[model samples]
Every structure is written in structure tokens, then in C-alpha cells.
Target: MNVLLVGCGRMGGAMARGWNGAHRVLVFDPMAAELPDGAERVDSLDAVEVEGELAVVLAVKPQVFPSIGETLRPLAAQGALFVSIMAGITLTGLGDALGSGRVVRTMPNTPAAIGQGITAAVAGRDVRMGDLATVNGLLEPTGQVVWIDDEAQIDAVTAVSGSGPAYFFRFTEALAKAGAQAGLPPALSMQLARATFTGAAALAGADPAELAELRRQVTSPGGTTAAGIAEMDLNHAIDVIVQAVVDAAAARSRELAG
Candidate 1:
């Protein structure tokens, strides 16, 4: 696979590094930042003299799509499989802008930098199964990928997994603060909070049901864990927190779409 990445910002750079070995990757970013070793770096699309069987990954911002669309319309028309990671950019929008039938719009979070991200993709009307397979293969290096039949679900996916990491980090910080309030040393509180979440996440991944059961088991008769659970359950805190995060993220995603 010959891959061309259109932007080299954080997400783009992460995907470039993750997908480098899977194909011959070329990067085009105007700023000329240092690229990962072994990837070809070009200053502009004019420098790209090759064509055919190329996978074009659009990592550029949504605002730059107009210029990029004009520049790549020819290649896109020639059947390059277009994969876009720009947030809130719909497949229909990308297809209209790029004049391409084979397009996949994806939302990938920062964890992709370390190959642990979860990405959701929606195929355009003209996307074929083969195109999807190729996109999946290319994205496999970065993390897990899921396909959605309804494009509308992408917004929910964005709210959940896309912005989910920052929420976890915030909770971790709060946990650390609470620990400090309980008189633990600052460093120890931070370490405990971080490690607790890490282990819990790992366990949840292994057996989510079992982890829930473990939580129940740990809550003995009128114990501290039970007390905390009671408070958390009193005002439907968990539901409120979950809904608030999802709503805020979805709203932001919609705003970005405009």
C-alpha cells in the first residue's frame, strides 16, 4: 500500500508513525516539522509525481478542506481511497468536496499515538467492501476499528470513545485531590489514583461483568465503599456524569461540523 498523509499534526503524525511500516508512506505538511525516520516528507502536493493505487489520508483541519479538495480532486477522481480523520467532517461532505466516491470518515482519539485508540468509521455511499477492507488494514496498526451503518452514530461515538480519555484523566485528578484531602502525601495520592484507574481499566477490559461483581463484593455491610456508593447513587451521579460528558462532547462535535 502506498499511503499519503495530508497533514502532520498530532493525530496525523501519530497515524503516520503507526502506519509507516505497513506501506510506503509519504507526508505533506507545509510547516516542515521533523518526520519520523524512514517516511518520505514532501513540502507540497506538487512534489507528488506518482499516481494510482494510492491511499490518501486526510489529516488536515476541516477548514483546509477547500484548498486540499481542489488540490487532490484529480487524484481522488482517479480512485484513490480517501480516509479522513478530521473530526465532525461527514462522509457526504468529504465526498462532495473531494469529488470521490470511495471515502471513509473516521474519528480517532489521541490514544492512537500509543496504538491503543478506538476509531469509528462510516463509509460513504460509494464505498465498496474492498475499500473498507483496505482502510481497516491501514488503520489496524493504530488501534481497534469499528464500522457504523448510520453516519449519525459517529457523533455519539465521538462523544464516548473520542473524548472519553480526557474525562478519565479528569476523574483521576479528582481522585488524587480527594486522596490528598484525606491526608495522603501529594505524590502518593497521585500515584494511587493513577494506578487504581489503570488496574481497574485493565480488569474491566478483561471481564467487565466480573469487575462489576468485584465492586459489589468489595462493598461489605455498611462499609466505606458502600458509603461512597450510596453518595454516588443518591442523586444519580453516575448517570448525570455520563450524560453530561456525552452531551457536551456531542455538542462540540456538532459545532465543529459547522
Candidate 2:
């Protein structure tokens, strides 16, 4: 597949790296200093050339769309499948801006840089099965791909999986701080906290058990794990905090769409 990737920033660069030897990728980002092997850099959108089907992956910032949306419309008119990974950019908005309804809106986390991210995608009104299949093929190299029927769910997906990585990182930082407060060396506390979280995530992925069940397995009736879990759950503090975080993110997503 031939791809035109816009804005080779962190996420765009990650996608470019994943697609590098697999597909012909043309990237347009004057600010990008370097690109992965097998990905060619284009000076401008007009410089892009394709013989067959083209997949234009938009990984630019949501705020940057307005400036380049017109420039991308020509490609969209040529039947290029548009896949947007920009946060809060709705399918309808993209379709309107690009003058093509064959658009896919996706939310991918930072782990995509390592080919372990989970992406949630929703098709625009005019997207056909073949277009979706092409998108799946293009995105598979980065990580897991989940297709959803309604675009409305994208905000929640963004709040959950899209912003989810930072949440885990923050929790790990907090855990390390707590460890330090309990007298462990700061560096050692951070090392343990980071490794423990990553190891637990690996176990979660390897095991088919439900997350709650997995937690239960580590929390004995009167064990240290149980005590920690109990304290965290006091007055449903963790639950409330998580809910608030997701709600705030989702709300901001809606605001961005407007």
C-alpha cells in the first residue's frame, strides 16, 4: 500500500517506523528532522505522487489541521483513504474538511511507538469494507486494532485507551513516591515501581483471567496486597478519581470537536 503520512511528530513518526519496510510511505513534515528507513520525505503535499490506492494517514496535531486541511483535500478527492489519529477530530469534521467521507478516526496511545499500542477506530459514513480492511492492514503493524460502529464512542475510547498510558505512568510515579516515603531509596523505589507495573501488565496480557480476578489472585484475605487495596478503595477514592479523570478527558474531547 502507498501511504502519505502528515506530520511526522512522535505518533506520526511511530506509525512511519512501523510501516517502514512494509509499505511505501511518503511523509510531509518540514519540521521533522529525521524519518525511519524506507520512509521518504516529501517537501510539500503537492509533491506527493501515487499510482494506485493511497492511504493518507493524518497524525498531525488537531490544531494543525485547519492550515493543511485544504492541501489534503486534493488527495482525498483522488479517492485516498484518510485515516486520522488526531485527538478529538471527529469523522464528520474530517469528512467535511477533506471533502471525502472515506475517513477513519483512530485513537492510539504512546505504546504504538513500540508496536504494542491498542487503537480504536471508527469509519466515516462512506467507508466501505475494503477501505476498512486497508486501514486495518496499515494499522496492524503498530498494534491491536478494534473497530467500532459508532463515532460517539470515540471520545470514551480516547479518554480510556488514548490517554490511558499517561495514567499508568502517573500511578507508577505515585507508587514510587509512596515507597520513598516508607524509607526506600528514591531510585530503587522508582525502579521497582516501574518494573512491577510492566511485569503485572505482561501477566495480565498473558493470562485470560478478568482484571478483577487477577487482582483478587494477588490479594489474600489478610495479606499486604489486601491492605493496600483496601486503603486505596477507602470511600471509593480510586474509583472516584479514575471516573473523574475519564469524564474530564471525554468532555475535553467533545470541546475539541466543537
Q: Distance (Å) between predicted and true CA of 129, model 2?
A: 1.2
Q: lDDT per prediction? A: 0.85, 0.90
- Model 1: clashing residue pairs? none
Question: What's the distance in Å from true for residue 192, model 2?
Answer: 1.2
- Which model scores highest in TM-score? 2
Model 2 segments beyond 4 Å from truth? none
Question: Which regions of candidate 1 are displaced past 4 Å?
Answer: 208-211
What is candidate 2's lDDT per residue for 1-258, written digit by digit as tens?
899999888878877877877789999989988887889989989878899989999988889998999988889889989999898778888988999999999998889878899999999988888998898888887799999988889889989999999999999999999999999999999999999999999999999999999999989999999999999899999999999999999999888887
TM-score of each: 0.92, 0.96
Best by lDDT: 2
Candidate 2 similarity to native, TM-score: 0.96
lDDT of 2 at 86: 90
